[model samples]
Target: MSRNLRTALIFGGFISLIGAAFYPIYFRPLTRLEEYKKEQAINRAGIVQEDVQPPGLKVWSDPFGRK
Candidate 1:
């Protein structure tokens, strides 16, 4: 391929990689803020006991001491 075409392809590929990396870490979380908030609230409240427990564990508390 021509040098200009190859350079364009490389630039496009770099942009695509950056976009893919940002989508999950930044854009997707922004779009799903409400869902993430609700999920976090449930976990904080220990609504699903099994999720907070492992074998032989009877109670769970926030290690950070946050209410």
Candidate 2:
């Protein structure tokens, strides 16, 4: 490829990297705990329900399933 084409490709790639990184660093809700919670709640309404343990699942504390 030509020098100008290579330079353009590198510049465009750099710009793309910067743009991709900006959203998570500056515009994403991951900057704070409250923001993350609010963002998660906005899209996932019923995913954070209560956790219940069944009677048969009581043996989950053991990794090897020993009695």
Candidate 3:
């Protein structure tokens, strides 16, 4: 009922709410990183094509053969 008590209660409640929201959005992914990696690996295994190579820049050479 007192002003100081009310302020403390409000501050505590705000902190608790922030922590609850962050647990799922931030903490959960970090804790499950390995599990997520495994799941992604399984999902991608069937999608990869062995014959197709990923795109990248090719080697460049000068026609004059400058030293």
Candidate 4:
């Protein structure tokens, strides 16, 4: 192979490796959280009529309502 062709293949492979390593840590959690939220919404709908909190990290309301 030509020098440029070999360099390009190496760069592409390195990028693919980085993406593969990152996929589970980044994308998988997001997908799992989405699935969990969907399930929680369904379950909450069945059990509760009012005051249903969505499934996610709980954030306390600021007492002063600044945020």
Give the number of the best model, judged by lDDT: 1
Candidate 3's TM-score reads 0.52
lDDT of 1: 0.77
Model 1 lDDT per residue over 1-67, tens place: 9999999999999999999999987787578877766766776773677865787976866333457
Please write out the lDDT profile of model 3 over residues 19-67, one tens digit for every residue.
9999987787678877766765686675645335456744433322456
TM-score: the better of candidates 2 and 4: 4
Report the poorest 10 consecutive residues by lDDT, candidate 3.
57-66
Q: Return the candidate ranking by TM-score, descending.
A: 1, 3, 4, 2
Candidate 2 — which pairs collide?
none
lDDT of 3: 0.71
CA lDDT of every candidate? 0.77, 0.66, 0.71, 0.69
Can you rank all candidates by lDDT, best first?
1, 3, 4, 2
Candidate 4 accuracy as TM-score: 0.49
For every candidate, C-alpha RMSD to the true structure in Å? 5.9, 9.7, 12.8, 9.4
- For every model shown, what is its TM-score relative to the native structure? 0.57, 0.41, 0.52, 0.49
Candidate 2 local lDDT, 13-64, one digit each (tens): 9999999999886666544657676665686665523354455554324222
- Steric clashes per prediction: 0, 0, 0, 0
lDDT of 4 at 15: 100
Give residue 56's error in model 2 in angstroms.
56
